[model samples]
Target: MASICLGRQPILDRNHNLVAFELLFRQEETEETAHVTSDLSASANVIVNAYGKFGIHNVLGHQRGFINADPDLILSDIISLLPSKHIVLEVKESASITLEFLQRCKELKQKGYQFALDNIVAINSQVELLLPLVSVVKIDVLALTRNQLTQLVNQLNHWPVLLLALKVENQEQEAHCRQLGFQMFQGYYFAKPEVMSIKRADPGKIPLLKLLALVMQDNDQNSDIDEIEKEFKHQPGLSYNLLRMVNSGSDGLPLKINSIKQAVQLMGRKQLQKWIQLLLYTSSQSADSLSDEITQTAVTRGKLMELIARAERPHDKNHHERAYMVGILSLLDQLLGIEMQQIVNKLGISDDMNQALLNRQGRLGQALKLIEAKEKGETASIPSLLSELDFLSLNELSDIETQVRGWTDHTDATVN
Candidate 1:
């Protein structure tokens, strides 16, 4: 149940009211620059994860969703899975503008599914063929020069399609698009992605490494407390943060927590382990990347996998814990810039954990893969993956993802 990192950009009307969100998508093996894929299944997966997995309302709230739809999806019955009332099917520019495509749009239009032309830069015969069928034309404002923008606007003036200016990065662009009669606006001009560079893992992680080892080796003995307390004493910063977080409004303790020992006693082994796993991400030096976003992703992934395991093995609490470990640890290589085996050995985790992390073997490993596939939008493997896990369906996966995301958001809000 690693959380699918669903990206969304708001689409605003001329009056700057939020009308809808364009759900950004990426699949496994795709380029970083590619937001939405041309693959029909990729689009379907996005829909499934968004409306199905993440809960359409959780991601979209009261507004609508504008999703990318390639030619195949536009013509196929799969697009029907998305309720027409909540989504505007955006046709990718590469889709051949043909009589059949138009016919399909026309048919869907009859059924109340709206359509838009995505990332249009110019007007031509093909564009003309589609202009009547689509309700909106998304123009990349950054892609068009001043003269071209004016010309394109004038060319489309008589057409019925509403113009949406995309990639609006400043007030000037916003004003220009407005003056040019663009009916909608989108881009970083509204909100920017907080940029962060991956830094080398902090040396501080060594203490966490010790704590992880101690927690992993717990034999339900009093000795576990001494070993863990010793590790905490060595890392004053970690102890302070842990105590502060546990007492802070986020943990919502009925009694104020004042000591590491108290926090450990109250949090217990399982809760404390998850807390430490989260600490591994924050222990990094970077203020933004590892501290906030990366840690959130790992936490979400871990929780999702844990939920999936619980669904599959209701009584096996140990399996659920292991699944969470596999998820958060899966990102160890990227976080630590070290080999998975090296990190696994250093942490003294079980062989099963090692196999799941390094080789993607066993039930926990499969759970990890299922989460990864969801994140990557690899729909092809989703059915087979679900079948192996007691026939969990796409809708079930969506619920799991949505629940984990909500939990992660709540935890992050508490910690922050």
Candidate 2:
């Protein structure tokens, strides 16, 4: 099998909720051109890799996935391999839209497949023809003027197809699209932090941070456990969640834990620390209500970094934990709506871990850079980063990513 690199970009609804992700992939050798000898073969490989190798639920969770489809792939039987109800077949505007193509798309639609017209610049004959067939029409807002966009949206109003603003880069674009009645949006806008007058951590999260500090203390004395249990006593919600999580058997605890003290003893400080870190994300909000994509992104990064550290160091457990911590903490600034230095100062992490989170300067930092690059679809930078690691190969890294996806998916389910 060819070494294929996979990437996903989130698509948000009008309310800025994560609704789906646009799944992207390219063969290792064809990174630049993204040219495949056979479109059908490449598409088949993507489906097999995403559904078979990566697992659809792992990659998509409960959300749908937008997959690009050329006419050949759209018309072929291979497309049926995907869960039709959970995938949106994104047909590019460049496809040869003939009567046969229309018929094939209609046939698929009848079978529960959804379609989105990709990179639509103007409402021409092709756009007009496909409007009724596709559930969505992705407008290339970057390519059009404000007047052109308004005109296009007006023309598109004839059909009930959802208007999706593509390549929206900032809040300005998102706001404009929402004002223009675009129902869905795809871009980096959500990842960008909103400007706020005061940047402070949420009050509810403060106790979780304190508990994390107590759990992560380096002292081996019994008093460390006492301090942790004391903190948990003050926060009944946190204690209940801890016991509930352990009882859920997601932590692989041999027996049920009834109290915070028992949890600390059986799970150990390291595992306890891990649970606190994750709990920080879900403590105040219900699992289902924690809809921010950044939380899932943080968890995925942490697990990937942890797995990579395990692969490299093998027996160095501390290094693995630090890697996971750094990966997750790297995004705390955006998550908490505060500065990275502020969060670091509150946690009082080691200098090395601090550097990894703030500056991306250490071994953990390098791992984070690789993960970020993969997330942003910067496939070109992957080779150099892999070379810098020196202990991992592209195939190995891909496998690690596959593992992380599945692990994070399971973690999300357990938390939910």
Candidate 3:
């Protein structure tokens, strides 16, 4: 199955506790357009993949799922498939709130479904019709001025619906919304992206590179446990993070792993490789150059490309792993502030991955293109880009995103 990238933006209640997650699906392509041929399919794909591949709890944890629904998706039996108690069906602003559509919503409401109005900009007749049916109204806090925000809140006061502020960018905006009596908030304000400068790789990175090389070695016969231990000893910080992660109860080890040797033996080469790769991505210490956001993007790209490679060539484990390497290393130039060729030469990665990183020529390179497109929110261009590879679909791509997000979150929790 092709792995898709699923992103969840947290929605918080008045007390700042996570109450729900808006399920977002991103497909990678090279184009920069937002026009998709089928909003219904996109919506349905998100619901299907969120419920099917990743499972609701994996994506949303214990919080409710806020899914956007088009008019067609609203009418379909797919809405009935979702657990009513765990989801709040969001009415898309573009959805024509005709009498028939409202009737269907009412039917679902009678069946114990909840609704939210997305992108509320005005108090129009259609919005007025949906106001009573929806339990929450999501207003774009960034798009509206203070006066407009106040006017919208004042207009909605007649209804018992809760106000949910979207696109809140900072504490100031969040506080402003709270002052305006908005009961819920959503945005990237909490963990803002850090600006990383172009600097030479740190001295500590040398040991990490050595450990990475040892772990990524193709041979199984050579017992390099002692050498690996030496590398960890050389870098105490990496060792500490490694031990902290192993003992964090995230690995589910029967006994506490106190030493690097114990970890290496128990984790094996493949698992160890994965763990080290994750560590390289998440390390925020002075030695690690990449910011959390950049690392997250790289990790997500690696996972999505790996899933795509798996779908294309199911029997080729090497290709799958290499595809993942391509994804993670695709952004190495930006992360390390080094030339792509120089970076690849230092890492000793495969020619295919090297070519993909530098020129985007091979299959892995094409996969990277899609990942870039998804990162750029170019969903409409993905289909055309992948026209040669018919096995991949937009929904499947989206599903992979969800899976990766869960994996990233789980890894972060474990490492932290």
Question: Model 1 segments beyond 4 Å from truth?
Answer: 27-38, 193-416
Query: lDDT per prediction?
Result: 0.68, 0.70, 0.67
Candidate 3 C-alpha lDDT tens digits along 95-129 = 34456577889999998899999988888777877
Quote the positional error of residue 151 for candidate 1 in Å.
1.2
Q: How many steric overlaps are in each model, in order?
A: 4, 0, 13
- Model 1: ten consecutive residues of lowest lDDT: 193-202
TM-score of candidate 1 to 2 decimals:
0.45
lDDT of 2 by residue, 31-70 (tens): 4235544343345545644543344665667788888887
lDDT for predicted candidate 3 compared with the true structure: 0.67
Count of clashing pairs, candidate 1: 4
For candidate 1, lDDT tens digit of each residue in 1-416?
A: 12334557788898889888887654322223444312443454465446423456556677878887766456443564455777898875542444666787899999998988888899767677777878888998899898899998898888888999989999999998989988898898885422111212232666777788888884765788877887887766566545543443121223466667777776577656655654455334122233344444565677788888888889999888888778778887777666887788778888778888988877778788888787777989999987776546789888876554433323224311
Instruction: Give TM-scores for every candidate, taking all chains together and pairing residue i with residue i.
Output: 0.45, 0.44, 0.45
* lDDT ranking, best first: 2, 1, 3
